[model samples]
Target: MVAEGAVFTTDRTVPIGAIDRWCSALLDELAGVERELWLVVAVTLVVDVWLTHVGLQHGLQEGNPVMRAAIETFGFAVLGLTKVAALGLAGVTRRLLSDRRGVVVPLGIALPWAGAVVVNATLLLRL
Candidate 1:
């Protein structure tokens, strides 16, 4: 049927398979990022352990309450928790990156590590 000056519309839905493929690609990318993050977490844990050992040996006081407690109690447990937290944060960053809204996530991940490096450097200098 046709009418003069009438507008027509057609269905334009995306295919389910296409959607599935897109999701798979995103998951694959996230998995790659997660693996890289695991390496970063491993390095961070090593640095954390070394810093904690040096800090304890030098009687350094931690500013963070939880870290202070961990430093005072079980340093290895704290290193384990640091790895868990890094992985958890990497998951969150992956989700944010998937959504293309993760401009600050990398910075957030690096800031603490940079701070630790600075503290470690100072500790080394003091030695």
Candidate 2:
């Protein structure tokens, strides 16, 4: 089973009208691509802050003594931020490609590298 939020690819069928409606809704939101980018950035920052504190607390409280030495409280926060940044970039790149619209084009270009770095840093380098 795919875990919640786990990234995967699959094919789906939907009516053209449905897709059009969805795109229209997205475009109508908050006026323009710039605002959308700002909103994404703000949300990413907020999530980074909250996830960092929570990950640190959880690691410190629940991990074994040996695990404690391997994990840095703040590092988790950084990792979270990195992931968010990657996703934000991807979103921007996708939007831009769709129509010089948002930041999705740049994001699409950067997200893969960002994700790889984050994964290696956290899982390979840190632990």
Candidate 3:
């Protein structure tokens, strides 16, 4: 029997196996997201390479000092290495995002790459 205005509550504990399954599902989802991110990184690298070629043709130089030095000293090999580094960083970003869910993480992952795309497009158009 319950009195008027009295509240009843029930507490349930999740089973360990259920919790493990849930965690595994979540990790699988994150892995899918990471794969998508890698795809984006790959596409971005292709576009970056094309942009670099266009920029070179137009006499535009690498803006980052370290990359500029690499380009000057080691040529296209360094450019390839830099693209590889960018892909690695994207992988790192995906891992970080998996660990920490936040709006800023995705934005931080995306904005700079998007900015580069825009800048490259603008330069290619202008040249």
lDDT of each: 0.65, 0.50, 0.69
- Candidate 3 lDDT tens digits, 1-127: 8899988768777787998788677666655575465466567667777788688778988777888887888886688777777667755765676453422344454557667877888887886
The lDDT leader among the candidates is 3
Predicted candidate 1 versus true structure: per-residue lDDT over 50-123, tens digit per residue:
77667767877665687778756886467557657875876677576754334335445655775776787687
lDDT of 1 at 119: 82
Stretches > 4 Å off in candidate 1: 1-42, 96-99
Estimated TM-score for each candidate: 0.52, 0.34, 0.58
RMSD of each: 12.3, 12.6, 10.2
Least well predicted 10-residue stretch by lDDT in candidate 3: 98-107
Model 3 alpha-carbon drift over 4 Å, by segment: 1-34, 89-109
Better of 2 and 3 by lDDT: 3
1 or 3, greater by TM-score? 3
Whichever of 1 and 3 has more lDDT, that candidate is 3
Each prediction's number of clashing residue pairs: 0, 10, 0
TM-score order of candidates, best first?
Answer: 3, 1, 2
Clashing pairs in 2: 89-107, 90-107, 91-104, 92-103, 92-104, 92-105, 93-103, 93-104, 93-105, 94-104
Cα deviation at 10, candidate 2, in Å, is 26
Q: Which pairs in model 3 have colliding backbones? A: none
